[model samples]
Every structure is written in C-alpha cells, then in structure tokens.
Target: MPVVFFAEGSAAMGPEARAVVARAAERARAWPGVPVVVRGLAATDGSAGFGRALSEARARNVADALVAAGVSPDRIRVQPRGPVPYEAMQVESRRVEIAIGG
Candidate 1:
C-alpha cells in the first residue's frame, strides 16, 4: 500500500512554505518503491503571514520537490488545504484516514 503523509505546520509565507515543501518532498522520496505523497497545509487569518504559505498558491510544490529529489509525480498528489489546524497554535497535529490503492 502506498503511504501518504499529511504534514501540517504554520507557514506564514515566502521561503517558509518553500522550505516546508522541500522537507515534505524529501521525506516522501525517502520511501523506496512504495509511492508516497506528502500533503502540506498552512492555515492563516489572511495577513502578511498569508504570504508565507504555499498552501494557498500551489500545492504541487511538495510534489515538484519530490520529483526533483527523484520521486515520480505520477505516484504523488499535492493538495491545498484552505482550513487546517495549527495556524495559531503551530503545535497542533492531527491524523485522518487515507484510502490507498484504488
């Protein structure tokens, strides 16, 4: 079964988002053979911080980074999250279901 990791964090905008995307892609690419997807979400109340997140503009940043690191994009999906936990708290974490192998 493919593994999909949901990585959530408080990214305000700019390099922060790019950095997170890079990290997620690195982790995803680490899983050999088994397809891996790293979904990154950033939550903010629309401010300068909003500029710090890639979750708003592009989701494939993670996937693109993964491909650059040698992972196949065909096996990955990067999704944007409009609302996510840990925007204010920055420490909150959650896990949900992921149905793989459709």
Candidate 2:
C-alpha cells in the first residue's frame, strides 16, 4: 500500500496548490504504502450545493481509482474540499483514511 495525495490543478486553487500537494505528499511518506490519504481541490462558487457534491464525488472517485489501481480498500483514504491557505479547511468535500497493518 502506498499513500498518495492528489489535488486538482485548477487555476482557482491558485499557484500555491502544487506546494500544498507537495506538503501533503511529504506527510504521506510516514506510512509508505500502508495508509493513503488523497486530497482534491476545485474552484466553484463555493456556495452551490451541487458543486460541493461534485467535488466530494471527484475525491471519492480518485480514492476508488487508487484501489482499483492496486491499493487495498482498507489502506485507502481521501479528503476533498475547497480550502483556503492557513485556515482550517471546512471539508466541503470529504475525508477517507485507511491503514493496512503490516
């Protein structure tokens, strides 16, 4: 199992999105291939209900894809949202965390 943090490269996420992804990936290294946490970000009106749902769905899709790609369901996690820098993310998307013990 390998942990991979994924985020969209949308312009709305700003230039810092890559940096955020890198930091998340670094954090993920702690568990190697065991516990995987994925985070996705998108730009929307930040007020539409449908948009939020779509974002969450995208995140879940990524996580599920990872599983299909070879990761165990028990070792997969996902977190999705439209986040702001430095502030606590509202989790407008979703969060999934899994750890497969060695």
Candidate 3:
C-alpha cells in the first residue's frame, strides 16, 4: 500500500503524491485481473459530515488520477474511511492509500 498525503481541508494531491499514484497505476497495468483498492482518509476535523465528504473527494481524485495514468476504471475501488479519531502529532490523516494485490 502506497500512501499519498494531502494538505488539511483539501483533496488535492501534490507532485510527489501524483508520482506515487502513477507508479500504482503501472503496477495495476502489470498485473491484469487484480483489483485496486483506494482508501481515502481524513483527519479528525470538527464536523463528521465534512470529513466524510473530504475523504470521498480525496479518493475520487486519486482514482481519477489512476485512470488518467492508464489504469482501467473497472478494476478500481474507492473507499472513503472517514476522519481518524486522532491526528498523529505532525501527521494529519488527510490521505488516500492505494492498495493493490491479488
């Protein structure tokens, strides 16, 4: 699983995150028939509804990037795991993890 982090309150991915997604897309291309699971996560913000929406947006954005990178949309699954209970010190929970395997 490769994690791509995003700034708090935003669903956008930076260049480095996009690179990770690109690599994941390549791996998905290499192994046909395997499913790609993209889990979107968010920090413990004040509002649960906002957090859920943000996380979902993050997942869809990453999924779109994967498709743009040539991965088939049929093999991709987006799961938004709402905000975490707590944020780790300097680490925020705003991220989407790309999990690809058999």
* Per-model CA lDDT versus the true structure: 0.44, 0.45, 0.86
| Tens digit per residue, CA lDDT, model 3, 1-102 | 888998878898899999999898989999988999999988764788887888899999999999999888999999999877655522547788899972
User: Number of clashing pairs, model 3?
Assistant: 0
What's the lDDT for candidate 1?
0.44
Pairs in clash, predicted candidate 2: 1-33, 2-33, 77-96, 78-96
Clashing pairs in 1: 12-52, 13-51, 13-52, 13-53, 14-52
Encode model 1's per-residue lDDT on 6-76: one tens digit a residue: 34442322554455555655555565556554444444445445523545333454455557766666776
User: Which residues of candidate 3, in runs, are more than 4 Å off?
Assistant: 87-92
* C-alpha positional error of residue 57 in candidate 1 after TM-score superposition, expressed in Å: 4.1
- Count clashes in each candidate, considering only residues at least 3 apart in sequence or on different chains: 5, 4, 0
83 Cα displacement, candidate 1 (Å): 2.5
Model 2 segments beyond 4 Å from truth?
A: 1-33, 46-48, 83-102
Worst 10 residues of 3 by lDDT: 83-92
Question: What CA RMSD would you report for each candidate?
Answer: 7.1, 7.6, 1.7
What order do candidates take by lDDT, descending? 3, 2, 1
Runs in model 1 lying further than 4 Å from the true structure = 1-32, 47-53, 56-58, 85-88, 91-102
- Clash count, predicted structure 2: 4
